[model samples]
Target: MIHLLMEAKKGRLRHEDEKTSENDTGFATVEESALGKSIGKMELTHDLITAQALVFFLAGFDTASTLLSFLTYELALNPDIQTKLQAEVDEAAKAGVSYEEILKMKYLDQVVSEALRKYPGGFILVRQCVKDYKIEAERDNEKDIIVEKDCLVTIPVSGIHRDPNYFPDPERFDPDRFSDENKEKIVSGSYMPFGSGPRNCIGSRFALLEAKVLIVSLMSRFDIVPVKRTTVPITLAKSVNLTVKDGFWLGFKNRNR
Candidate 1:
């Protein structure tokens, strides 16, 4: 994959140079092919070529799949929410939800956002200081601290998401928090399911889009209900990992006929 990308990059550069040389003429005889056009946009910089391919192979699927699993679990646990979501999906179906329509779905976005908040795929993010930073003592017991350049810092995403200060009744799986009326009240920099600022997950949009498509399709055709073995208030068991004493047990009941 890297080799192909590198070769494509080289071809793209060569093509661009050719175009530049032919600028004197009103018309340049460019190759009439689709691959050439595609190659023109392919990027294979030393920093990104290998990493891009590897991230595509791994990062995209795992996080989105994890989110989907928990979304199913959440809906199963809250039958009322599940029914409400299905009703919303039913309306979208009546109106013919296209790609644009799916994204604009208000309730769908709320449910997905709430799921991400409840079960962040990556619980934390790490960053390094580019320069020296000073922390003034905020409490009497603490002293001023200096963090020099390149010092690593950890940000706890789950802690922030679950904090009652930011989210009232943080334990409740309520999608209304992300609704149009209530979402504006969310404290800035409080929700970090995909980290924050510039270095956050690059594939967040892709992940959300994939999640929405799967959920919309599933809810439109079936119901996510708790089975006999399903556990409620899914115990994190004093562990942050998405696990219960009894594993997530959900039932998918077909709504058709």
Candidate 2:
């Protein structure tokens, strides 16, 4: 990929140099765009651009697949939710599957939100403390906790998502928790499917859009049902990223048939 991008960068530079006007700034590809911006700058190296591309690709690809896998598994297990989501998809299909209409899907958003809550792409979030911070005591029995500068803090995303305090009866697959009325009751920073604050996953919106689009497209023509090989109460694999122990085995039944 880097070799191809380097070749493309050379081609774009050659094309731009041949142009009569130095101000002509049309870029055909992402490589061209990045190369154009970094042409005069020494700090922005080819290695940096390659790293950026890899990060974007890996982060978006794997996480989106993981989200879809878990979401489909949940849907297969809970046919009622699938039926309701299918109805929503059917309603949306009348006007066609445009970005605007998909964004307007309330139940779809809720279902996706619930799936993220249940099985987040990343289990933990790590942040390095820029400066010293103090945690004030909440009750008389508790003492203040001090975190010095450069301390590494880890937030267990999965643990917090399943906490009864934030999500009551957290084990159950409940999309209503994200309903307009009930969602407001959720504690801040408790629902970080893609982490929270400024340094959160950059591809979060795109990832959600991808999941929604796939679900809508698939559920529109087919129903996702569990097969004999389907694993109930999915066994999580021992890895940094979320994975089903034996892989997700689902059956797609044609709705028309």
Candidate 3:
């Protein structure tokens, strides 16, 4: 992932250099061709570009690490699910697996989704109020609850996912919670694995697909089993951004034909 980021940075620099050369050689012209408006743009500073690159790199790394942790925990607890996933992968491909082929594994997709739901990396979504607003009182006799500007609002993802009100018997590891018919019953803001709105993670699709591919390739040939010293109810690390607790440990046994 770091190497990929470096490559992207190099490509961006090359493109900027080519743009500069074009401007110098009169190959490119800046014209005001808009809706009767002129907009001025400034070149991004080196520090700003570097910061942006670091943010993206960290985001990708954190997301990938969290996903791997989730998969590890699930595989450790449910050996049968692991075997079933492996069978799905074997049935999906004749020879080695391809990216397109991994996409077609519906059961694998559900497993990944269930992992995300069970242990979302970001357990809380936080936001600050931009303007003052008033919410209706819970009881008919009470006054409205006023929320002043700049008040911090925290949406507890872990709590929401475990809430029996939204999800019936939420503690169970049931991927069918997201099945077609049942999924429609999920409340709007309650099921935000990648968050919602335009500000949500843009690379969710890529991240999910990559996870599927990695797991398919892994489970196709090996069975993951729990090793000693690993805790049963996965403990979470306090310092990290994701849900990873003590590092997940597992043993790999190659499947015999």
Best by TM-score: 2
Q: TM-scores for all candidates?
A: 0.78, 0.81, 0.77
Q: Which wins on TM-score, candidate 2 or candidate 3?
A: 2
Best by lDDT: 2
1-257 per-residue lDDT for model 3 (tens digits): 34444554455422222233221211001222242133333355567667877787678778877887778678868877777777888888775677666655667766777777777766788888889999988998999988899999888987887789988887777766766576677787776677655446655766776677678767877788888966788666776476545677778878896
Report model 1's TM-score to 2 decimal places: 0.78
Task: Give per-model CA RMSD.
Answer: 10.5, 8.7, 10.0
Residue-level lDDT of model 2, residues 1-257, one tens digit each, is: 46645666566433443433332111100112334445562354687778978898888999999999999999999999999999999998999989888877889988999999999897889999989899999999999998989999999999999999999999999999988798888887788887765566766766888888899999999999999999998899998799979999999999973
**Full candidate order by lDDT, most accurate first:** 2, 1, 3
State the lDDT at 239 in candidate 3. Answer: 68
- Runs off by more than 4 Å, candidate 1: 1-50, 237-246
Candidate 2 total steric clashes: 0
Per-residue lDDT of model 1, residues 38-122, tens digit only: 5436445887877888886698887887789889998887888888888888888888977766765778788888988888877
Worst 10 residues of 1 by lDDT: 22-31
Could you tell which candidate, 1 or 2, scores higher by lDDT? 2
Which pairs clash (backbone N, Cα, C closer than 3 Å) in model 2?
none
